[model samples]
Target: MRVLRKRMDKPAHLGGVLRDALKASSLDVDLDLYRLWEQWTDLVGPVIAQNARPAAIKGKLLLVNVSSAPWMQQLQYLKSEMMEKLNSALEREAVKDIRFKIGPIE
Candidate 1:
C-alpha cells in the first residue's frame, strides 16, 4: 500500500497528460475546423485568399466574396471543383457547399 501510494504521487508526463485531457474533451470536429482555418491560406493560397472564408451555420460552408461580377461568374462556374479541392485537401468532406456574395466596394 505504501509503494502504490508513492507511485500515484509521481508527476504525470506533461505531453501524455495533455493529450489525454484533449481527447477526453471529444471536440474533434471543432478542432479539425480550427486547424483547417489556420492552414487555409497556406493550403489554398491564392485560389481562396481574398475570395472565401469558412462559415458555420447549419453545416460547414464557404462564403466567397468576389471582387466583381465577372469573377463571380467564373467562380460560380467552378463551384463544385473548388469544393472538391478544398474538402480533398482537408482529408474530410467538411464543406457541404459554397455560398458566393459580392464583396464590399474597395
Candidate 2:
C-alpha cells in the first residue's frame, strides 16, 4: 500500500503571487510609490493632477513636480491631505511627506 501526497487543488492568482513576492523582497512600498505617477489623477483630482505630478521617491518622502509657483504653493497646503490619499490608495503608509518643486508636468 502507498500513501497519496497532498497538493494544492487550485493555482494562486498571478497578481497576488507577484504582490507577495514583491512584499517579501521589501519592494512593495517602492512599487506603490511608483504607482503614484499613473494613479495621480485618480488619487487626487483632475485639477490637481493637471498642476502637479509625482516625480520621484526618497525613502518615505515623495517628490512632486508642479507646473507653476502658485501650484507648488497650493500643493504645500494639501501635502498632508495628498499623503493621506496616497497612503489610502496604496493601502499602506508608503508616503510620510510630500515635497513640491516648480517643474514641467509633462
Model 1, 57-87: lDDT tens digits are: 2256666566667767877788888778777
CA lDDT scores, all candidates in order = 0.66, 0.86
Q: Scored by Cα lDDT, where does model 1 land?
A: 0.66
| Cα TM-score per model | 0.52, 0.73
How far residue 52's Cα lies from its native spot in candidate 1, in Å, is 4.7
lDDT of 2 by residue, 8-80 (tens): 7998899999878987875865786668877989999999989998887877888889999988888899888
Which candidate leads the pack in lDDT? 2
**Per-candidate RMSD, Å:** 7.3, 6.3
What is the Å distance of residue 76 in model 1 from its true position? 0.8
